[model samples]
Target: MAFYDDGSFHQATGVSRETLDKLRAYAALLEKWQRSINLVSSATLPELWRRHFADSAQLAPLIGTETSTLRCVDLGSGAGFPGLVLAIMGIGQWTLIDSDRRKLTFLQEAARITRTSVTLLPARLEQVTGLTADIVTARACASLETLLGYATPLLEPSGKALFLKGRDAAREIDEARKTWNFEVRRIPSQTDPEASIVEIRNVSST
Candidate 1:
């Protein structure tokens, strides 16, 4: 949301001074670690605040305020785009899951520096079980059909799944309907016109 300029994001999100500090620290960590590992695309690093931070922070508002103490699970939380950012914004009980230990290592340091509490799961999504959450988030992780497969098992009956997708999102939803029965709402992205957030609820096998 016009995060290209400094302070624009803070204004838009209305985050506290403490939360802003944590986000700044997170940006620093991402820049530092990127040289050694591919946390995010090299091109996007120059626009980290707008492309990554803002993109991730946008999910906070979509969540219902009634859903307090939200249990959030971020599937394939690479560089913790929305997951780690959500943790800094104090969303709820956070769990960042990824198969890459290296990425998990980076997330651990980021969480430590930001002074955010998070449960790190360093394993494939299928290996994790008995984990139910209220809000599930996945960004640039997988095809919509595949994401539903992973999320369906971990979501509570009334939970919501917020997935960040590009222009092809509508097609993905159409494809997913072939196997899954659910209610979906599309929210236009504040950053990119071609991108959107797909919110799915009441998911079930067809």
Candidate 2:
């Protein structure tokens, strides 16, 4: 989608007024924290609504609406792109995991300011275990192969993983298949045409 303002987000997504208010709060917080820390790419700040908010918001439609609640775990939730955005949208029960404490601190404050609830895991992917969820997500985190390794243990039996990847998505999927076997599909991204959302299910080591 083309870069636009908050009105574009509201018109496209049709999110509630409360959600929009929270998103506005999130945008302000993200911009404030970015000066002191790298919350998002500096270049994307000017178009925050289109670049970040809308990019993350697009994933909501892909998430099945059949269920009233979905337990979601976001691995390597740096500055909470899809994770924090989804939480603000009230997608479901959220667990955001990241290795950086400072980022987590920023997320904590953002959640407080937006009044969004999330379970934050301030730990590395390898350090976490016995965590399962209906939906597992990651964005700009790691290679597809490595992401599968991190997401594998957190998936519920019927869960699926939605990974946002850039132009190298196809190459990463091909490489990931060497050590893993699963049903995977590529969903074209609305924000960046060259990028894609890789959805994986029934994952297992080959």
Question: Over the stretch 119-176, how does candidate 2's per-residue lDDT look in tens digits?
Answer: 9998989889878899999999999999989989889889999999999999999999
lDDT of 1 by residue, 87-180 (tens): 8888878999999999999999999998999999998987889799999999999999999999999999989999999999999999999999
**Model 2 steric clash total:** 0
RMSD of each: 1.1, 1.1
State each model's CA lDDT, in order.
Answer: 0.91, 0.90
> Each candidate's TM vs. the true structure?
0.97, 0.97
Best-fitting candidate, measured by lDDT? 1
Report clash pairs, candidate 1: none
CA error at residue 92 for candidate 2, angstroms:
1.0
